[model samples]
Target: MELITEGIKKAFILIFTGDREIFEIMLLTIRVSGISVIISMILGIPAGLIAGLNNFKGKKFVISIINTGMGLPPVAAGLFVSLILWRSGPLGFLNIIYTPAAMIIAQILIASPIIAGVTLAAVQQINPKLKYQAMSLGANRWQVLWILIREAKLPTLAAIMAGFGGVISEVGAVMMVGGNIKGQTRVLTTATVQMVRMGNFDIAIALVIILLFLTFAVNLVLTLIQQKENITWAQRFWR
Candidate 1:
């Protein structure tokens, strides 16, 4: 109880006073996670949508692959990335290890599968007949696709939030890839680990509080959108 009170007081002071290091670390965390979210959206959302909407050979296999990827261990991802970026490795020439770029790469790897899996689940729940109906109604491929995506907005937003949460809380992958370098690749999760090692409990707790707040905000927005739509499982997900 005493520790919690002290930590809260310190957190308020640090935030109110605009502690430079805290601000820097927080901004860097946002940058890494935001970029990762964008990358995940690009790689995962579209693929998930396609997988969900289309029927093809090996489609289930592909979805299974994504589902498996969602549970990938961050430490393993970091190790694999490290190996690939080593001097004699195939991607070594890019020289991305132990840097912010590496952190971004790690985060993208962590986030993409979650985004894809969630989106795929949402997509799969939509009615197959909707696609046929849309096509029969003179909706061109582009138009039909747009309608389906727009209808899926609420679930899609949930998937995006899930992806964001998965990446922001990850520590092992980023730490391994970035080496947790100070003033360079330090992010909230990794910074918290470092702070703990240094006995800076107050700042670590503060960061945790902010992280929790962010997760809550993201999930709240997603739920709010879903509620506003007032549609059934796939009804809002497919036009």
Candidate 2:
């Protein structure tokens, strides 16, 4: 209890003092996770929409694969990315290992599937009649897709939140690929782990607190957007 209290106090001190190391780690964590989630959104949203809206042979198999990926282990993702980025490995020429880019790639692998899976479910829940109605109105394929996406925007925001949550809290994959190099690739999760291993419990707790604050702040913004959208949608329905 005393340790936790002390840690909480230390966290405030670190934040108020504008500790450079902590600030840098927090920023890197946000940058890596933020970029990963954005890329995942660009890739995952379309893939999910295509998979959900289309009727093709082996579609179930593809969805099953996505579902499997949604639950992929972080360490496994780390290992796979590391292998590809390893010297003498297939894509080793790019030489991104042990860098923030490598961490972002690993996080994208972890986050993309989750976002895709959630988006798939969201789009699939839309009424089939809505698509038909839009088609009857002479809406082109792209127009219909846009309409459906708008209808699913609320849940898509949820998918974004989930993706952000996944990548922000991730440690194993980032650690493996980034080597947790200070002033470069270090992030809150990895730093927390490092502090813990070094028996710096107060610092570790501080890192965890900062991580939680980041998570909460991001999610709070997402949730506000979602609820505002929901309210607007409800108003439209009532009209």
lDDT (0 to 1) per candidate: 0.85, 0.90
Give the alpha carbon lDDT tens digit for every residue of 179-238 in model 2: 999999999999999998998787787788889989999989988877774455435647
Stretches off by above 4 angstroms in model 2 are 230-239
State, as a TM-score between 0 and 1, how close model 2 is to the true structure.
Answer: 0.93
What clash count goes with each model?
1, 0
What TM-score do all the candidates reach, one by one? 0.90, 0.93
Say which candidate scores most in TM-score: 2
For all predictions, the C-alpha RMSD in Å is: 3.8, 3.1
Put down candidate 1 lDDT per residue, 144-165, tens digits, no spaces. 7766776677788888998998
